[model samples]
Target: MKKIVISISDEQYEKMDAHIKKGSALNLNNETFSGYGLILNNAEGGFSWLEVDMYTNLDLGDVNWSIEES
Candidate 1:
């Protein structure tokens, strides 16, 4: 399988987080996680991805993710 690396904004991340949580709440939904979810689930820590979402399937590596140190 071809690896897909996506760089999204904070706003987008929040959206994905909501979606993943909704899917997990169901009784039968074991087929809605991304490949990288094995390394980390959004609910367990941070960030989220959907195996069924179009955004997760896209190749969005052009976006620049800024890191603001506090």
Candidate 2:
């Protein structure tokens, strides 16, 4: 499988954090997860080719994921 790397800026993370804190009183929904959740969702969509390959019965390897800090 191809690799997808997602990176968010410090400012972006802070904004996400603030949004989460502000909504802490409410139930979480899509809007509450538009940060990394949306990013990972889009990445999965971008990697939909793997699913397409499975539709054709291709012997694709297992999906793998990991987080790294730099």
Candidate 3:
């Protein structure tokens, strides 16, 4: 599998932070996995999602998923 990362400006980070403090969620990115899960391909995995939370501390082991905001 291939790995990827994204970076945002300080202003954008601050904006997202404020929005989260007010009680909101942000969907940074998404990708679909095998709907059949392990029943299908051995290398295939089930569906997964990555999210950005209020504190801006997040990480998902698979697919090298991680995000940071300050």
Per-residue lDDT of model 2, residues 1-70, tens digit only? 5555445556555655555554543435433432223323224444421211111222222233345554
lDDT of 3 by residue, 1-70 (tens): 4434544456545654565544432223223221111111113464433344443433222232334443
Q: In what order do the candidates fall by lDDT, top score first?
A: 1, 2, 3
lDDT of each: 0.43, 0.38, 0.37
C-alpha RMSD of each candidate structure in angstroms? 11.7, 13.2, 14.9
Candidate 1 has its poorest 10 consecutive residues by lDDT at 57-66
By lDDT, the better pick of 1 and 2 is 1
Q: Which one is best on TM-score?
A: 1
RMSD over all Cα atoms, model 2: 13.2
The TM-score values for the models, in the order shown, are 0.36, 0.33, 0.30
Deviating ranges (above 4 Å) for candidate 1: 1-3, 28-70
lDDT of 3: 0.37
TM-score of 3: 0.30
lDDT preference between candidates 2 and 3, better one: 2
